[model samples]
Target: MKNYILFFAAIWMTVCFCSCDDGRIYEQKVDIARGGRTLKLTGRFSGLSNWADGYSVVVAGFNDKSEYAVITKSLPVNVADGSEIVMTLGGIGDEVTALKLCVVNRLRECVVDFHTIESEELAAVTDTIMINAGTLDVGMYSTIQSQVFDKKCTMCHGETGSASGNLFLTAGKSYDAMVNQPAHKNSDILLVKPGKAEESFLHLVLNRDGDTNMHHLDLFSEKEQLSLKLIDDWINDGAFLNNK
Candidate 1:
């Protein structure tokens, strides 16, 4: 019985050791098989240093949640000068079918710019892809700007002096001025809340619900109504400033 127990223990220990050692080798083999290459990103000449001290380029799997997961990040790239910046992504897995790019502020951890690229599109690219400055294709904030604020709200709240209720709905300034900020009339209600659109004063006024009796008759128009829905959707989708 003692010999039998000793033999089984020896077998178990050997199996454990082999399995642990093999796992690493298996992973390394897979990585080699998957292969990798460097991807270059070129962007327009914009003084990024005006916004943040430094920036990082992040890549992640092609999913809404994975977009912010930061699978890999580049070290700080020079953003101080208006000269063109080229960011190189090394060891990008061949299996990365679809991916998103996130340019983040190193200090605040906020994404200043974002974009999505498909594998097919990447394959077709011979040269570095040009990045749009301060734009995100899938972000809720950009949708709101193009659909809602630019179409309707800008009439009253566009430029600084023209903005009514001390609110500015210009492209770059709108997010900061409204997000988590108090309403002009009602200090208790926020103009836009990150995840709670129903609680937002903007939703209340547009829908003519709650204590706010003021409703824009223009909202009854089909275009304006669609804009209102887009705004509501934007708020529901975490009210993200840069990327979805």
Candidate 2:
């Protein structure tokens, strides 16, 4: 009986030791595979109301060549203004060249990049990376001006030579020129009638079926739905210059 008891105790000790050793080995392997990489973001968003439909704000990782995101996490939209935002992107892969805080359209294409972490910065991260993006005001009208009018319309509208239709889309002049003002092409309709997108001539010219010159609709292609929505929502929301 004494011999039997000693044999069983020895076997139990061996099993326990093996289990502990295996656990340590597994943990080490996992750590090596993961490289202890992580990204932590802390910030607050202002002008939350400016976010339009069919678009989402996201924290995304991307490669240098593609506009499409490699990995993305949607941000909370229902939260009140100035609410603390805490997010983490862990186990980042080597192929991911950059990380950005931006708005993406329904197709997952980045519409605008608000903040970015370049590849060099990402490569230097040893363990946990921390980013404190101070208050961001993501207003829609500003986005429309930069992404739409600035890129697509400035040439004919106001950037150089005579302003076509006597309208200036240049900054500090566009708002007063469009809001509550009559369209030069057609004096019967307002350029942008606050609280009504369909009634606004600006929205009319952008719509494919709207009552305007076909050339106006061709200026912005169908792929630019995000830009169209921004303009539409801004008008629907009273077309305010500052939506705080």
Candidate 3:
């Protein structure tokens, strides 16, 4: 009789366990107002060059009316060039029916193809997404070296020897020599003030808008000549070390 009772009790417990197990299989959804949960991201960086400074993985929300994605936030990623980057990104609002992830250059310019995930797609993934940020452009610094200085002014400012104006248009030294440092000719003016474009002597020299009537070089409208506004944009953008 006792054996029969023990067998019945064991059967009852098994049934209860089976009932609770059914609740565990369900979808995980984000609360619309609470800004959703963070997702783990693993990705590879490719084709990074000396000019490729820093990078960021940005997440954007979708606009229903426009059927477009606009970047809402960015996850700053700091990793060595050409290495796999592993990080987590948040700010995924529940209302975000679609998500766009992109790798951007230091200037926040998109360098790689963007990945888009719909709400239905995101729900299907159990955990972790692997993304690859492929080859970025050589970027502004490289552009300046190859086109601006190399073609126009490297005769006076190159790394082969001591450059005139104490500026070296070498592969790696030009950015530092220009940013935040005062111009060789004028102490009151900066060569390339990081956040101050108009005040930079380089801009004044190129556009001939400085206190000194001395003109360095005028930018020609020829297709080959870089626009003078590029100098202004570079300086106004917080002239980052290593083009950060």
Candidate 4:
């Protein structure tokens, strides 16, 4: 009986040692899975415009086929000019094809991408990834010109010799043609009245309920609500040619 008791005690100790070792291994894995895989972003925003209620800037992960973000974290918009910003996105799964610093609408759709980390680059990361984006300019008017006017409106307005409503939305000419300029349809209303979106004819014509013969609302899809809001905010913020 004494011999049997000693043998059993030795086996118990061995079992306890193995159990503790396994527990430590499991905890380490859990910790890694929870917080080890991360992407850190550091940069300063230069020409940021006023962000509206439904629109925001964020660091997000996405796949190739979808516009909707898989994971996202909102960036601070109230920071002073040239303030160094640091943001991190943790627990990034293998399914993420790309990571982007971009403007997103309320539906989490990426409106415009300011910076991108491609899948090939992301795959190289075994652990934490650090990226310095340098300085990004996120002014609303430039974004509006590039994304909306140049792409959508210039064909009818500036690209053709016969500009619609005598408005030219092409680059180098759009700012002067719109801001504080009188609308051809209504001489009394300004195309973009500084500090007042409600009084701006450009804002009014973009909306569905606005009294206009032309269905300008059709030009912008459901995906462009953020763009529309940006225009309104730009007008409300004095419609400057340069926010810097």
Weakest lDDT window of 10 consecutive positions for candidate 4:
46-55
Order the numbered candidates by TM-score, best leading: 4, 2, 3, 1
Choose 2 or 3, whichever is better by lDDT. 2
| Best first by lDDT, ranked | 4, 2, 1, 3
Residues 1-244 of candidate 1: C-alpha lDDT, one tens digit per residue: 9999999999999999999999999998677455564556665433232221243445443323332333455524354434555566655554555555554334323242256777787666543444434322323465457555776678888754578778898888898988999999899999998779899988888887546877564455752354465567667767777532
Candidate 2 residue spans exceeding 4 A from truth = 1-32, 35-49, 53-55, 62-70, 74-88, 91-99, 105-109, 114-137
**On residues 45-128, what C-alpha lDDT tens digit does candidate 4 reach at each position?**
755555545667788989877879999988786788789999888978888888888878788888877778898998999778
Could you tell me every candidate's TM-score relative to the true structure?
A: 0.42, 0.62, 0.43, 0.63
lDDT of 3 by residue, 55-173 (tens): 44465555454433444455443456556655665655455565566544454444332466777886664444344444433345555554566666777777568797777867577
lDDT digits (tens) for residues 15-54 of candidate 2: 9999999999999878857754677888988655566566
Residue 6 Cα positional deviation in candidate 2, in Å, after optimal superposition: 32
Query: lDDT of model 1 at residue 21?
Result: 99
Model 4 ranges off by over 4 Å: 1-33, 40-45, 49-56, 62-70, 73-88, 94-98, 105-111, 115-136, 160-162
Local lDDT at 14 for model 2: 100
Q: How close is candidate 1 to the true structure, as a TM-score?
A: 0.42
- Kindly give the stretch of ten consecutive residues in candidate 2 with the minimal lDDT sum: 46-55
Error of 4 at 7 (Å): 40
Q: Evaluated with TM-score, which candidate comes out highest? A: 4
